[model samples]
Target: MDYLAATAEKKYLMYISQNYSYAILRPLQQEILAHGGEVKWFLEGDEVNPDFLHQEEQRLMSLNDVKEWQPDIVYLPGNIVPNFIPGKKVKVFHGFNSGKRVNNGLDNHFKIRDCFDLYCTQGPSTTTTFTELAQKHGYFQVKETGWPTLDPYFSEVENNPYEDKQDPRKTLLICSTFSRRISLAPKLYEQIKAFSEQGKWRILMQFHPKMPSELVAQYKALQNENLTFVETDNVLPLLKAADVMLCDTSSILLMFILQRKPVVTFCNQNPDEHLVDITDADKIEQAIDYALTEPDELMAKIEHFCQQLHPYQDGLSSQRVLAASNELLLSNPALKPKPRNFIRNLKMRKKLNYWRW
Candidate 1:
């Protein structure tokens, strides 16, 4: 028997569409390699940086490569898994499912589509929701291994907790979801301008990768002596650098929450009492003050929220996810994940335009 075929180790294929998700999936790749499994990578869009591939350039596979290899498992960080893809389709999810009202909230983030064979949920809330959805929909398996994106926070223990820069100025980070309905950037620009003009704090703005470039340009124009706009694939380091965060329903808030820092969200429909919520644009400054001054009062609630979302601070979620992927690969029925729902996924494909099929 061929060594690749005879060995118990499985082959894993990962589809990373956005650079931001790269860090989230890296740990899983490391774990699979450690377990004697072969790992292949594929970039979803033109945004891929060839330099990032480094020595692993040979491991980068195309859609045709995916068809030829037919790995035992497929991991996707986003919702759409494409039609007729080989292997067990697992949804590792891009971020927390905070139930923001985008497209009436009917997307697969809340509803189950047939393309995913398994859902590796981020926390208790999401796991419970998807577990009920799995039972109700009757098509998939739900596992509550905390999101691998967050594994870095737990596993790579920090020697020093976040500390303010030596400069006396407090730092503020602004992040938002992409939906026009819920995105705070559009609504809060004028206020942001006023806040930045104050010159009291250092401000950094990072947008969702999917946020429109025109809108990003508009925000970039606001940059001044105190405010800076950042466009990057990774937000983790910035999250560590900020003293407070302002966001509206982006799962990125969970990352900041894990650091036990206070966040202020604007126009958030599904509000968590633990977050400082502001409906009035004029109240943005007050919210910032509260986050900077009263974070201690919210520390208990923030910790409670973190525990409920993910109880494990052990940093082994990637190993758990890979282990679960292997178990499913061994026992999952021959049933392939169904094609994307034409009406829903088609519109999304036209909107995002990444999948070749």
Candidate 2:
């Protein structure tokens, strides 16, 4: 008996970046491979340059890759959809989008949902929100797979290499990025400086991968013995060490939630069109201060928020997502699931109201 026949051979493609996005997609891809499927990875923006494209073409042709590695299924991990190739024999295509809110116009949502053969979501709220929006716009069939990223946390061993030796001074994890769309640097810097001056805590700032060297240098210049910044390919280890997490709208906060760690979302910028309303800045700052000053209160709030945000914050979330994917694959073997009309319509309403355009 052929295992591939029993499990179904799938050619999975994932675009990787050095961030939480990769963390969310990697496990599912691994699961597919473990089940006797073929997986291929394409780095984000990997073949943008003409030189690189030419090299890629030569490599493909030299290896007779297109014919040799005929992909039955293609999986795109994030929202960015690839252009369909003519004459390509892809049997199914799966796309995953994990944003808390939808920023692009309703048409954009429709475009993305319609482009992929199957669509999977991160959380129940996101699923419901997008589903309604798609339905409003006359789309149906978006699958609520929960969040695959949170899966690892469910079963993750609490093996903190730094746990036994954690500095009693209290360690805070600060995650931020440099974005021209919103200037959070000054506000974050001010908060960090203020917290450091108290001499009761130490900060470990994790810069976004796209942040420039000069920007990091400027941050490093302000560093004292109590404040430190490190550039790393991964932040999971740091998240494990942190007593609390400070971040903007980045999805890393979702990871903190999964870990049941205290989190303070920096709401200095206006809410994006696609996401939930802005968390109040004053409230945000107060929350951070509360977490820093009152450990018990922060933990309580963390537990409550985890219950509200994700039903399953433990690491088993990946299994849920995988099961959803398998269901879609089995139910509609010919065409993958796409977002329904309800989500598109709801988003259209939001766009018309100027709530999210």
Candidate 3:
């Protein structure tokens, strides 16, 4: 029996449907290219602009293209994938679960949609949970490969990306989750603008791609000498450059905190010791000021938090993810039968406009 060894002839599909997927899966693309493996992208939804595809990158234009070009495995950074896609589905995950829950209080992050054959988890925080889920589900395997999006974050950026920002003062990255109910972007706009005008810190603000355009515009208009607004598909650059972060509730905050830096969040729904959480918009300034000081207790807690999250900083997570994928193929693990969710599959087919068997 062939073990389906990973070779130069191996073909992989990068299944992405969000703006951030470009950054999350691109490092793995580079690794695939380096190993002489074939990689192609399929941007699933309108939320992902086709123009964002680099000139050198190839994208499958239609469902027919995806169906005909049988790939050995599919790597997905987002939550869902069409069941019709012909490949072993793997979920690399989009972000850490920083306490955002569904209506039933279930973790959206850990929700088993029964779509993936493997999960390349980020660290111990997720690994143990995903492992238990894997045992329960019996149809998917879990591997702690870290996150590929952050590979470049560790190895590529120079020691001083801040100097390039031209700001000696502490840098602040302001971001928020897209939920209207919890987002502090709109409420804290004046405070952020005033802080920027004060010139005590350089402000770098970015929002989720799904963030309402009008609200995003409000912050965009406030850009001045001390503050800059960016909307790149990748946030690692901003993450690397930021000295601290101000936000309400978003996985991006967890991303920044991975550096063991302090984060000031406004009315975080799941406020923990890991964050400098404040209840009022007016309190953001004082909260940020306290964060900038890097209180020893907060710093120490952040250090512990970092270990549970992504502990890898060697910039080789992409390599690990690929290797784990190959291991999965080698094992061809026997799995229990999955439920026939015809309704879900139908929705997926309609979304992609592909119904033909």
lDDT of 2 at 147: 59
lDDT by residue (tens digit), candidate 1, 1-357: 232222246778877777776777877887777668888887776766645664863455566677788778889987776655678888998777677645664754676567788888878867878888877766688888887777677544454233335658998999988989889978988988887898888888899878988889998998987888987665677787788999998878878888878989998777876799899988889889988886665877888898887777788888778767766766665444454478766665565553665
**Evaluation by TM-score, superior candidate among 1 and 3:** 3
Candidate 1 lDDT score relative to the true structure: 0.77
Question: Could you tell me every candidate's TM-score relative to the true structure?
Answer: 0.85, 0.68, 0.95
- Which one wins on lDDT? 3
Best by TM-score: 3
Candidate 3's C-alpha lDDT? 0.85
RMSD of each: 4.4, 8.9, 2.1
Give the alpha-carbon lDDT of every model.
0.77, 0.52, 0.85
